[model samples]
Target: MLFVGGITLLKNFERLMEAFARVHERQAIPLVVVGFNRWRFENDLAFAKSHRASAHILFPSFVADEAMPQVYRMASCLFFPSIYEGFGIPVPEAFATGCPVVTTNRGCTSEVAGGAAHLVDPFDVEDMAQGLELVLSDQAYCQELIARGRARPPTSASTAAPVNPWIYSSKYFTKLPNRRGPRASLAAPWGISREPLRQCQTYQGTNYMLPPGGVMVDSPDRGRYI
Candidate 1:
């Protein structure tokens, strides 16, 4: 089975659908897409219909985090041809779960793949299709990617503590005063609300604080806070 994880506009679901259609025409491989967004969901549904791939593609939106490892393990390869990403958490997540990846040749996704993925041009539907076909048909190549992925460093915050101890340390997350009262002044130097900081504190049940005036963005893919 072919798998595409984390659907979003920037995730380039359109190109993936088109490519999957091409591959399906020749092989009839099933494509499972996991994730959800109202606008993206509707648009992707239309795109799949237009490509004549709606019947072969499965959209099981919003898979729980606890079950994601099983999804990855079941997948022959995780197609993540995102046009943009802060860190592309799914690449590492897939790696950790023994799933080979097919991701964009550029940007953070490639970096996250770290030579373990089948790199494809996200803008080129044919390239994406060929990459998918190669991974699905070539068992040796697929095993090579799985071996490389298994050798990659741990990506989750909890497992990365040995590599970066500060990630789990108390100093990494600064406690900010409440924003609704006089204590809000204490957070004035950072010029950000307590809610954002609180989000960092609780992200993945780990503590992470940004520097003064630093911006904290929660990646839409699996709440990968950075």
Candidate 2:
């Protein structure tokens, strides 16, 4: 199964949905999407339903924190082709869980993916579809990506450099609290320490401490998420 976690317009749900539609057109792989609800849910669903691929997409919006690691373990790969990202937590979360990642090259996602992900164009459905195909069709390549992800632990030195610019410029994190020592280990239920999620910051100014990150909401006007 393929997984795409989080919510946002920048996350390119429509593009992902359409790309999955194309993937389904060629093969019958199911997509498991986990996140909060979106305003375009009905429209995205309608589009996928029209393509007759709705049944192949699963949306379990609220997976308890206790059960999230199991969700990642079940996934064949994690697809997060966002047009913009402050720093994608899910990419590393999947990486930590030994799941191959497929994300966009744009924005902070590239920085956090740390050359361990299958970078794709979030704007191009065909490109995203091709990424999906490559991951699902090439077991050796997929395993290689997973192995690389494992080698580069979330907060390890391997992932510290090449930080995304948004890591400091994000409007959501404008009021970030100061930190002295290394951040506390923020692990999910299954010993998966979520480090990249530290970069997420919502505009509403909600506190996003600890693992698993915060609930993301996209602003239609700015096309940014928090």
Residue 110 of model 2, lDDT score? 83
How many clashing residue pairs appear in each of the predictions shown?
Answer: 0, 0
Candidate 1: list runs displaced more than 4 Å: 1-6, 155-226
Clashing pairs in 1: none
Which clashing pairs does model 2 show? none
Worst 10 residues of 2 by lDDT: 160-169
lDDT of each: 0.69, 0.67
User: Which stretches in model 2 have alpha-carbon errors above 4 Å?
Assistant: 38-50, 156-226
Model 1: residue 87 alpha-carbon error in angstroms: 1.1
Give per-model CA RMSD: 9.6, 11.3
- Please give, for residues 1-226, the per-residue lDDT of candidate 2 as tens digits: 6555444677787788888888888887788877765666666656656655788888765787557667787888888888886556777777767888999989988888888999998888899999989998999999999999887645432222223231222322334455332323222322133433333322233333334433332321232223
How would you encode candidate 1's per-residue C-alpha lDDT over 118-155 as one tens digit per residue? 99999999999999999989999999999999887644
